[model samples]
Target: MTQKTNIQSYITIQNNEIVLNGTSVFKIEPTDFADFSKQAYRNFDVQYPKFFKMDALSKLAFLGAELLLSPITSGEQENNIALVLANKSSSLDTDVKYQESISDQENYFPSPAVFVYTLPNICLGEISIRHQLKSENSFFIFDAFNTEFMSNYSNILLNSNKADVVLCGWVEFFNDDYKAFLCTISKEESTKYTNETINTLYNQ
Candidate 1:
């Protein structure tokens, strides 16, 4: 018998609002991404001080992962879970800030802090560190959310035993706009993991 993968839980954040499993858990007035993220962090009472230091992309990813993975106790499922995240912008939002810091030859101030987040996968690192998920992880850049790739890749990871569960989705932050739709997949009798369902949750 083939093992079936199912979406254990899903969370979405966009337009200053956060929805988990089809319920609007948090919503705030229109504001900049920085303030919105901070408010969400406080509203959820997430106590990771390092969250404040992350770039926009990392902060967005961290918040989604934090909420989606909340039911599972930290350190309980150490290396069984994998993270596979995709985005269209690919950290360009942070790249712009980093460039400005060193753009001026005379006033060139290259910040190691900002420089570190130039890669999109850094968001994965932030989540992994927080959850202690030491397993296969990858970040892909696509013109849009590739549900086919996400479904296939996650299914392989789960079926092959590369990971007992796969947490994958899109975390996109560019300009002042941001959206995150993260989901956990495992062999459970719930929402069947499929391309259509992934698209539906993302659009929801």
Candidate 2:
């Protein structure tokens, strides 16, 4: 059996961007979600040439994946990495717009482009392409942070040896407030993590 390892990282993108790696990185006020998406794409150096016209879901996925993969030091373990995410909206914002577009007969045509964002898991696809990761992926939605689910599922993946690393977090985009926090876990014991440690950090 693979040994258990846990490592943690935190990212806050609210009024400003703050990344905790023992200290704050920097902060900037994004004009909007699209602007934030563009900034992230550039930061990760995503090579996709046709990103602009992509649907909002795809755009967010692209940005999320870029953030997850940027700090990875073990791309060599691509086969053993999993992308697990939880969000509150579950693409409802996109679905709402899509439904509105079709609600009126005068503008009843629903574009396939907009329809695609209705599902929350598309972000996994964007991440897979960005990192060339072919490992397991999943997306879950709840009214609030489901710590129990996140911890249980991630532990299962690691203990089962199905993956050597797991990237798990919360990514929510609601109106003007957007927040994301991601952490990585492995089978090698590292000084960086523990259940107690995580709880303490989170409480702070």
Candidate 3:
């Protein structure tokens, strides 16, 4: 039942730049993750009030997803789309922030909004909420980008009946360094989904 999967659209955000496919979309001040994400959010003209309450990790993931997937109107089968994201830092960045918020014995104040994003998958939830996509999604932690893993898992999703599409890739953020390389996978067979292509796209 294995079938071809295509890269519908992909976006990479890093090094003070945002690129959708091979085209440069925007550039920023290259500041900290917080400030840069705020600027990028504005550049995309996203009107989500909840975006402000999201942690740095969520913001990075959200922006990348928005830059790529926002324009496409989903069909009734959108619920069959899957989300598969991986990262080296996982939620450590926000975990540290959350810890610092409660580590202080005197202040000892933990913001519920901040605490909510302690898991990396919360970003996926935010995307699901925005697009109303009810589908299978997973978050992975890796030392590096495992293109092979992503390709293989996506193949499984398509070969089986578990999913009709998958939004898969890496979303990593640590301090001022962050990157999100995300793409939509479907059986439409537009752009070939291969290791070489993903590596080239990620490096571009």
Which candidate should be chosen as best, given lDDT against the real structure?
A: 1
RMSD of model 3 against the true structure: 2.0
Give the TM-score of each candidate.
0.95, 0.81, 0.91
Off by over 4 Å in 2: 1-3, 18-22, 50-61, 71-78, 194-204
Which candidate would rank higher by TM-score, 2 or 3? 3
- Model 3, 85-177: lDDT tens digits are 999998998899889989889998799988888998999999888778888888998999998898788878877867777889999988768
How good is model 1 by TM-score? 0.95
lDDT at position 81, candidate 3: 74
Name the top TM-score candidate. Answer: 1
User: How far off is residue 40 in model 1, in Å?
Assistant: 0.6
Every candidate's lDDT: 0.90, 0.67, 0.82
Question: Which digits, one per residue and each the tens of the lDDT, describe model 1 over residues 127-201?
Answer: 989988889999999999999899899999998889888999999999989899999988867734454478788
Ranking by TM-score: 1, 3, 2
- Model 2 lDDT, residue 82, Cα: 86
Candidate 2 backbone collisions, by pair: 3-187
Q: Which ten residues in a row have the lowest lDDT in candidate 2?
A: 195-204
lDDT of 2 by residue, 1-204 (tens): 545557655444444454554455545575777776677667656677767766565565555445555666355655567888888888777788788889999867879978867788877776676677888899999897686788778888888877777877777775646666666767667765555443344444
